[model samples]
Target: MTPDAGSALAGLTGADSVAHWTQRYGHALMDTFGAPQRVLVRGEGPYVWDADGTRYLDLLGGIAVNSLGHAHPTLTAAISAQLGTLGHISNFFASPTQIALAERLLDLAGAPEGSRVFLTNSGTEANEAAFKMARRNTGLDESGNGVRRTRVLALEGGFHGRSMGALALTSKAAYREPFEPLPGGVEFLPFGDADALRAAFADGGGATVAAVVLEPIQGEAGVRPLPPGYLALARELTAAHGALLVLDEVQTGMGRTGTWLAHQHPHLGGGIVPDVVTLAKGLGGGFPVGAVVAYGERAATLLGRGQHGTTFGGNPVASAAALATIGVIDRDGLLAHVTDLGAWWRQQVAALGHPLVAEVRGEGLLIAVELTAPVAADVAARALAAGFVVNPCTPTTLRMAPPYVLTREQAATFTDFLAALPHDLGEATP
Candidate 1:
């Protein structure tokens, strides 16, 4: 199909589009998120054309899920070939791609020999599986106090996922309050605070805690990278106590942040290897897939054959997509490209000199701009009208996770537009 095939609604609709989505689809579909910024119709590379034919540079990369950019010939052909050959089969049976992807992920994370993997369909499911593995490994659950363990530790502003099991581990009140009566015994500590983290585990009866779950770099709350030595400290404390360290890499994994695993960074995450590593975004290069990479004894011993199962977890099509994505990332040397370009982009953005622009920070393609003014949502809208697309994480923060394949020219253009943001305010973006 031509790229135009994807723009089914472009040029043919406008005023009724938003209203139709609200009146017809809002009730029909779940209202988990509010109305979208625009009805995006089609995309190629960093450019997306909305229903109105307004082209936008997709700085969000579908929330860091599209690492190879959009519709690269290799990714498209790989998915098509796999779909044509063999799509999905029952989990009771396995395929080559499934096993290969799992092995590849372990190798990428630098897991020592004997590591294992569990596959899922979304980041939340991956975390759920990891949490379950932690519990099962402790030989508890399905029983009273002694049978089940309480006190799962999470970091403030850290987002793992949104399912019940994952939700219990998340510390956000807004995301957790509406759905109360959740599993209890979960504790929260300030993020990037080594002392607070040390204290939390210590207070949790330290050695008795089931596991410590946290994102190496908090993504959804606006690309918050952990301070240096924090992760290493977590590793040390978890070791001192016998608690499992679960690193939620759902956002920072799959080379979104320059390294295959953000934890490979020398300072923020560095060489510290957590007990459990969860990944999803950018795993399938825009397709739906998630995984938990557990090293050595932690992987295969999580559950027995009858303990867990999913209909589409290890399907061939998604696995093939993941394998292909990983292949493209490696063959193209995108990891180094990400690091160099990210540094350049961040440095250039910092030169904007807008007070609204307070700071620029992030690892690779995943970047966040803190503005002095609380007008992030407005700025995002303005950016869209200005023919670029960005996201407002907070009133004072702009989040940009453009694809790894982005060029220096694209980065320069973005810097210009960002510098003009203050002027665009009070007026329409264009």
Candidate 2:
């Protein structure tokens, strides 16, 4: 065999297949996500198999992206049918599924009559579209001459995305400093701090701000939900100041929190709609699709004919996958299933009486177990060793976002493992 062909075959089959591939990965790929924990081979429902055929319950759900879990028949079938019929088309043209998905998103959003949709491939792209819309809503054309309003505001510890514009709205200094001089005029205030929000609007010089973006539930900040009336307060403040309110529902939307959108939850100020909403993550079940939905004429018309475009935004197969996902969620009653599972799981985890676990907080299947000690990384590692997959969002927060179709028995088994974490790690049992 040729040298390159021989090298490829060296890692294809072996008892140490994962090790060989991991070594190859470190050499071939960028060191962006650090070392991968395991080399996953395949998945079904909420379980995944490793290179060695070891199975794990995937509690993280691909960082909240896999709403219908792995290998969901409906999602897979929809994608296959659409790809077989019509794979993709350019933005210059539109497909039946594309228009249908847009209509379905508007219906799910419960948007007003003139609401509009802009589709993209991921959450960052969705946020970029929203940011551009916010800029345009200031009545300032692309020319630098007419600058009506330029400032954008976000919340502390809130994450929008990693792209330059979205990263500017993200509050993490480590994430922002590396990409210095980001799209400027973006400020962050303490999340859920009503006083801080009110004061910022008060000092905005009566319409110096273009938009205020926020996540109703902060996922990267350890599943932190907004305090009572906080979203309503934001709506009131932004409306009073004539600034747009952009809700980044990238992580919390798509029934992850047992609602079409977290902001629609009664506890989170139901019936209060924002000017713009960004959605991705679970929208396509495992297929990649993101969208920006604008409510009124003012917000919808911000981007004119040639302002923005996407090559693979509303591909027929991806749109079909999303439609199938939404249909399954509604047909299988996953909304109520996730609601009951979330409450029950939280109660069981908290009642485990483990000394390390301090509190459990979240909505629906999106949850975080705050540790009394900063042993979250340790716990996650231990859980993986015990055949479960979880995420350590922070040093003290263990985040869990399992599939909507996860059964009660699967949840019970995971909870039982969590209760035995300390003992499994060779520490004294609680």
Candidate 3:
């Protein structure tokens, strides 16, 4: 390394360390994310330390990415061992780890025979692959002469991803306005409105529909799950109309919702099977990996050879990291732990009777505390100052997705903070 770089690195622990790195971050990085929250140096389990050596409970889990928590021994060792053995062989070749992970995901999803998996490097890319799959399944005629379907339906408040195709499937106006003329034929339905969904599919509209993409739980829109029977209706309509049902489990999959996939939950998913399920976030625990699971022969063959591809996707190390994460979750029984702990924790927070808190909602550890006012940003700031990480996902919601390994004692600390929250905390809401 350069002498200047070495000197700057050595000063990371000095006084004014956060200020120094934050200033450097502004100059060296793009401002897409506004500003750095903290210069985190290291993490263990559910805790992380800033460059200044002040520790904080990581309740956000890297926006629901760090499933096994940071620097988990098993995840680390798996990545290291795989890298030592063989890291990247490109998509031109296959590895045992990649195959094993695909099999595991299919098994977890209860996929039918002839199902397949296409791996990617991020959630957005996984959705992109799913998008193409939807487009390809455009209801072919018996004679296979004319393309029949051309539209894809998504829900309002749904967040698929930011890339062009995935962004087209996302609903927020602010996210879509700037990128007008996106891949066309994506329509947004009112979230959880069975009437609107039915109307869209009525009057032969379903014939022109290619797919219905949805999130089991809308994470960015304040951790809202689809209203009961909504998913089942979608599945039924899609099946009747010959349209693909794609579930974007990027934020809700891989045990984040106390289940392998949120759609597997009886209450949330209504026991309906979707044709396509896209996954990422915690799939690799902390490593970068994503996947598109196409169920059945028809969906699996939508993307034939050369229809979709990636370079560093499904690399041995990433596959091993995902395998290790799945192993830990299964062996440790973190799914049941998350289900029980999340239910108990939400109840405890709600019982605190904090005036700012209007409601506590979500499944498993993926939670959102809705405020009576739009003071989520201010409350999140307070949480940071108090050595806890959280996300102001919306004006009135504080989202938390702590690691699965978090103990009740550690969770109680946050509840204690909530119980003692000041009444005037929202006075300076911005």
Candidate lDDT values, in order? 0.82, 0.88, 0.92
**Which regions of candidate 1 are displaced past 4 Å?**
1-24, 139-149, 423-430
List TM-score per model, in order.
0.91, 0.94, 0.97
Candidate of highest lDDT: 3
lDDT leaderboard ranking: 3, 2, 1
Q: Flag the better candidate by lDDT, 2 or 3.
A: 3
Q: TM-score rank, highest first?
A: 3, 2, 1
Q: Over the stretch 273-364, how does candidate 3's per-residue lDDT look in tens digits?
A: 89999999999998999999999999999998988899988999999999999999999999999999999999999998888889999999
Q: How displaced is residue 177 in candidate 3, in Å?
A: 1.7
Alpha-carbon deviation at 261 in model 1, angstroms: 0.5
lDDT per residue (tens digit) for residues 223-259 in model 2? 9999999999889888887789999999999999899
Error of 1 at 361 (Å): 0.8
- Span of 10 residues, lowest total lDDT, candidate 2: 421-430
Quote the positional error of residue 140 for candidate 3 in Å: 1.9
TM-score (C-alpha) between model 2 and the true structure: 0.94
**Which stretch of 10 consecutive residues in model 1 shows the poorest summed lDDT?**
1-10
- The whole-model C-alpha lDDT of candidate 3 against the native structure comes to 0.92
User: Who is ahead in TM-score, 1 or 3?
Assistant: 3
